[model samples]
Target: MTTSATQRQAAASVKSRPPRIADRLPAEGENGVFTESWFPLCKSSEIAPGEMRGFGFLDGRVVVMRDRQGEVHVLSAYCPHVGADLSVGKVVGDQIQCAFHEWRFNTDGYVAATAIGDPAPKACLFKYPSADKYGVIWAFNGETPWWEIPDFDKPADALAIRVEYDVPIYPIDPWVICANTPDWQHIKIVHKIAFDHKQYRDCLVWNNYSMQGRLDGYYTDNKGGALETKAGIFGTSIFMMQGNIGGRWIGVMTPFGIPKPGHTSTYFILATEKGDGSPADQQIVDQTLAGLYHLAKVQVGEDKPILRTIKYAPGYLTASDAMLAKYLKLVREFPRSHAGGEYIR
Candidate 1:
């Protein structure tokens, strides 16, 4: 059948339409197969020496353990033999001893010995590259870490830090939440931060895995206090900022975790410079950090409602959205993988 001129014109118009945001952005295969980024597994103090704990990680499960020598290791949770949960197992010397079969696996995740007294088989668990830093245990997504764990510009011991791992969980991808950093409009409108837009636009730094922005302004609270801010998002999951807020020096690091697809848990690391080793000075530092943490929570409360309900389609982006636009681009090209496979379960 031959098409009419009008019919041909309609088909041509349809083909010329721009693709949707989903199509435009690079696709990450599945929710479980996440981008190659550092994921905060648990607090360092939670897993004491000679203790093992299982956590629901990325798409599956992992065990964080501390050997007798005080070395920390994060390996896939279930045992290679009989699928016993290693978290319930005991730590023997520098190895993991399975509770069910008495099989022993070392920090390298290879079976050190078998309960039956026979030579151990060639089975091994997936040992995730992990680091204990900033009072948290972090694991990288792929076999090797893309970059070092995020840290403040100042030395850690010089700062008084309070890490809150039980912050509210967001029912969304971690990247979606991290988009907050580059979202200038959201910062200005929702968080009440006022800064010179032209200066900020000129001074913003963009890199492959991170973005940093500086703002000098005042918080539009009733008092209109002076504020100078420096903020950055690293690896699509960790958001960190340090600056003077209302004449107080504060630093914050929030790294997100994925228990599974469509769910994210946030960790808050609040810090300020430590004072002189005196009772009065300690009290002042404590109060300053406490107040800083409270402000962090308040900001989270402000963003919670909108983030929870956002469909997040960038249909009509404006100039104010340039930073968010860059973040989305970084997410598109970021590496992704289900690194541990079935052993993580």
Candidate 2:
């Protein structure tokens, strides 16, 4: 018997539903949502010339290093030759020499030179596209060609301040912190701040509703006259806030997952630019960083325990989770082959 076209279509639809095992498995685009874009990976200072830094990103292990020429290169940390970590290897000229057998790979991750008695490796280490901008290094893992990478550049006139620190919460997916900025109720409950307080309460409420309304604009409302706003791509958001209280203070938060599954982290930086002729400008910048660090410890540190303990279920969502809903929607709609996965673990 021949199946009709309608019957074939129905069969195809059924095949597309995620399998039962997928309940615990994050959607392709859901876990490490990868789009045709650039996500900041690290500060320029973090990877110095002739230095190799191992990083866990996009659910996989990647190594970032600068050659003697001072150019940056990113590649899979695992050596394709023997599964050795490339980070332990040293940079010889433009090639990375593997520590195990001294096998060298060029900036493009192609096998450049193999030591004696070594058979030509079947495959070369995977190379990730990377670029430098705004004094930061960005890595791309999308399936599309490198030419398709998105341009991520900040304005030259914009006051830039860069701050870096390691959060103690490891293995706790970074999206939790990334999503926290848009989560309104948490600020009051977790941070234990009076949501009704004039400056604090008003700004929180505005940011919460603004994000819900999907308004793509800057928001600057704080006791210190700081402005914090974010931009969204697909369902992910990049936060940028700057305020000129005593001096110009800027903050940026970008979230990314590892190349594999089961890992995520956010890269946060705060920069304070000194204003001209402002006698108190330097002090203001210093105070701002100090104040922000304290706030981060209280707000982010407190959320760590709660977020880590909560059971994660992909489809388990609530009406109050507006940002979560938007995030999931973006995951469902975008290509996930390389994008970060869903917010849920």
Candidate with best TM-score: 1
Q: What tens digits encode model 1's per-residue C-alpha lDDT throughout 294-339? A: 7778888889999788766667787778878888988888888877
Query: How do the predictions measure up, each by TM-score?
Result: 0.90, 0.66
Per-residue CA lDDT of candidate 2, range 237-327, in tens? 2444333322333443443433343444444555545455365875676676676655545545677787767544455455656655555
Q: After superposing candidate 1 on the true structure, give the runs of residues whose Cα lies further than 4 Å from its correct spot.
A: 1-32, 222-224
| Candidate number achieving the greatest lDDT relative to the actual structure | 1
User: For each candidate, what is the lDDT?
Assistant: 0.82, 0.54
All models, RMSD in angstroms: 4.3, 11.0
